[model samples]
Target: MTIQSSYPYYLANRAVDANRDLEVIDKHTGEVATRVALADDAVVDRAIAAAVEATPAMARLPAHRRRDVLNGCADRFVERFDELAEILLVEGGKVIKDARGEVQRLIDTFRIAAEEATRIGGEVLPMDIAERSEGVLGFWKRVPIGPVSFITPFNFPYNLVAHKIAPAIAAGCPFILKPAEKTPIGALVLGEILAEFDLPEGAFSILPVPREDAARFTEDERLKLMSFTGSDKVGWMLKGKAGKKPVVMELGGNAACLVDADADLDDAVERLVFGGFYQAGQSCISVQRVLVHDAIYDALTERLVEQVGALRGGDPRDPETFVGPLISEDDAKRVVQWIEEAEAAGARRLVGGERDGAVVRPALLDRVPDDCKLFSEEVFGPAMILERFDDFDAALDRINRSRYGLQAGLFIRDIGKIRRAWDRLEVGGVIINDVPSFRVDHMPYGGVKDSGLGREGIKFAIEDMTEIRLLAIREA
Candidate 1:
């Protein structure tokens, strides 16, 4: 059954239904699956004001209650897991298998946030240095950073939204969420589930607005911080406009995977197939680049081409579909143009570069020059580039040529080699014997340089949402 309905945005605890509705289209069919409330400038301001008004209440709420609220939301999410997955399929055009996994991630994140709520603590300080300071008693505790604003992207809407909302709830901070207008149903339904919990009034809001119309979200002083997950250009612009308020961004990346000659070829091939093309390659940390040793380059490239070719790219509603259409036809066109440009720049197509509507068949290119956009910029589409390297130092250096340093994959059994990569790679996280796209949701996930600004694991985000308050008492 096709899931179709109208969803409302939250202005604090009050459900706001606007007359102007944004149509949520199915990327594959280009059909309207549902509609969501579109927030005008006035509504966006009200949401921010509501968040500011609720900050004190969130601070005063008991830790236990906060834990319960998060747990309740997780429980509700688990109960409606399939429903949410269906929405993700229609709204984000995610393949069903990936959608299911995203749904489970949502549940895991909320549950993790629930556990983190009880762990919010501060360390005791002992002051006994000098005679004058010997009697001073000093300590610090974590306090909520008031209201937070999150602007999430179209990819992985459920889990990314959870990354922001769960931490705010865990840290007892009021939040305003601005989900991608094209894929807002997952977040809107999440708001509905959160509404079932015993949360304070004016604690949260989920507004869907045009990208050009969301400047207030960044410029408003009422919001203490803005957590953005999207393209590099947009995210940096948001940071520029978000003056005074702290801003955390999870921007774009051409995350790469390296295969050493001593590595397991079969294992590398399997992981690369999934990592390089999952979700149509729209992830910030997707395996966009594969750097293989010269000795095993031919063998690994042959296997990868065969494996990637075997993938079925079709309707996301089908459970067997491994790849689906992009977010829109324009995105698919953009990807095709990039691939063509790379080819003209001397890159050779190894397998799959066909396009049909919004579906660009999984593209694998070889000999892609470092100057090509496919190699230097974030593809954020279904395309993978393979290059061979002789020296380990040169290969690693090439990885750093791009501005992005989000994550990298290294396939090696040598402990020394692994340690070298951990020390040398400029990325935030490195996966050994696997792919760069591998993430467990609990690990510190962010990038260096242009990749992102801060960490985003459950506990880490909770720390970002709260600030330390020091209390010093001197002997009378």
Candidate 2:
């Protein structure tokens, strides 16, 4: 069955105007499968207006009722998991298995957010008085930051959008979600499913606005918070222009996978292949650097070469296809350019340096010079760069050299080495046994340095989305 929809962008309680048709390209075949509506300034205004109007109802809903509504949305989402997966596969270039995985992650996030809503609590405090008596009483509670703007990126469209929308719903905040233009259908479809429930009209609006106009909306003082998941460059731009509003950005990361001397080579190869090439390596937390302890460096490289060679790039709908086309031909071209630049600067491309249209075969590079572009930057493609270090301290130093501090993984059994790396890695989270991509829904997931500010987990985001208010009373 072909999933067809007319409205491209939904705003403020209605699917207003279908002015522009956003051509959605099937990443696998480079064919246009469907068109989504892109919103204009007028449409954006309507969304903003609706969010403003819905704030009162959002604030008025009791905590328990809000939890019920969020849970209902999650239930509705799980019921249509297959449909959601199909939409994601066609529109976002995610492999069928990964599309299903994203759906499951979204479900987990929603459930976690629902649980968080019920646990939103306040604390009672005792006050010491100098003016009169010691009978003064006080307590503190969290209040929702009204009119939150959620700007989600293209990678993992379904789950990332859910990460933003679910928490906003749980917090009882009116949300204006601006999903990435290239992959808007998945978000719009989810919006339709959400609209089916008795959500107070205008409580949530999904806008597919152009990237240029996105900055304009952030300038609006009516927006209390801006949550973004995208590039580090744009994340900083948001912080600058967000005015007085609070911003929570999940920015870029050149995630590292470290294999110490005591590590298992076979297991490291398995994890690296999955983490480096999944979703075409477009993930913010994708492992971009592979640091080996020089002892098993050559052996690990050979195994990685064998594994990355077998990765299949083709139709995303095919369950057997391990790799799929990138979001666009242009993005693929850019990846190609970056690899070529690295090679020109004296880096040796070991395997998989081919690109056809939007698909690039997974590539591995070694002998990366200090001046090579790939050594210091994120390729954000199915490419991995190898760096060998003899001393443990040197590997830790090299891993922390980059400006991005998102996530890092180390495969080792030495307690002292693990503890030292944990202290020296300078990232948001350190995984001792798993890949950097292993993220649970409730754990605080974020970065440090230029990677991003603030953390994103169900409960953590809720705390960031709200402000504390203390109530005090004394004998009048």
Candidate 3:
């Protein structure tokens, strides 16, 4: 299950041992775990050109063939489940349990894509609605959107990459992917799996390169669409440069979870603890804010703090570890600084604000000012802020005040309030009786506003990766 000391990047479905210039660090130990081939601007250009050349062949690929390819990948992922989870732990600093969960998600995403591949159908239109089209028949079907590009982030590297790659394959769109440099092994390993398939020569390329050198991934006119998953800042910047191409962004969010007076305190506390600190809170939709009703705020906070404080923090290799390291020391320092700033600004740290290297103990705080970065911005770390709300509508309004509107969670016993939250909340989705962090692989998952654009489930992503072509027939 150990990773290779060096791995090659894929260029046009071929392994290229160009250079092991990029050293991927084991996030838990802060040591170099593996080195991966890095693609330069020329390699990127070549990959794009290859994708452009292979577009026609990819589009001509049969749906059955595409399904087979995806199903094959899913089966392979199952065989190497432990290996993939191990890589996630070493490269991404994800806890063993979370790593395995992501691996399972990876399998599920590809399987979903397999099911959708053959079902990419269109509907027949009734052209007889108009008198002029009385004898005419019309229909439209979706086709691949030509060459596409992807840039995935470090968090959830495997499944997020699966989100893009699986759909593109199912849609028969040739694509080029730039996985996060810090955790490229997972993507590179996926590239290895994909190379075994009989896809078009240049249908896909996985390049592990520096962000600066990846300008072509966004700027190149050859790519018909760009799908990016990362910080909002970088996602938007890439969109501006993407020129004329469609862009699908899954940027991070400072998601909020509301606990109502009638909610089950025990259930809410357990889910909230998992939502706020799972994978060290590196997920985009990780619960960053908890708004509890005044009636039970004190009780919920007590239970939440106790659970968060008890979470085990250590090497991700240990099955007992719940909270692992951040991506890097700098990231850990950044989270610590934000926590300190909030504490200095009158926020009370309930428990867990210590750091050792890249690992920061999960922290819980309350009475945080609305203006503090810890409260206002996306804290992609193991820290969450607790606040009291006296009114349900006021709590809904408070969640809407943020620029990000990815997803919100509500723990309520009343159906009316749940429906009201669904109707009133500006977020893309509202999780009833569950944390916002809950996401199934097939559900429409994306955000609004600063949280970014478009959705990323298999069918939704397939929609973005395709275009509609109309067919009209007239009987004489």
What TM-scores do the predictions have?
Answer: 0.98, 0.96, 0.99
Candidate 2 whole-model C-alpha lDDT, 0 to 1 = 0.84
Which should have the higher TM-score, number 1 or number 3?
3
Per-residue lDDT tens digits for candidate 3, residues 232-339, read: 998898899899999999888899999999999999999999999999999999999999999999898889888988999988988899999999999999999999
Per-residue lDDT over 57-117 for candidate 1, one digit per residue giving the tens place of the 0 to 100 score: 8999998999999999988988888888888888889999999999999999999999999
Task: Write out the backbone clash pairs for model 2.
Answer: 8-37
What does the lDDT read for residue 141 in candidate 2? 93
Query: Which candidate leads the pack in TM-score?
Result: 3
Error of 2 at 313 (Å): 1.7
lDDT of 3: 0.94
Runs off by more than 4 Å, candidate 1: none
The lDDT of each candidate is 0.90, 0.84, 0.94
What is the lDDT for 53 in model 2? Answer: 93
Ten residues in sequence with the least summed lDDT for candidate 1: 12-21
| Model 2: worst 10 consecutive residues (lDDT sum) | 1-10
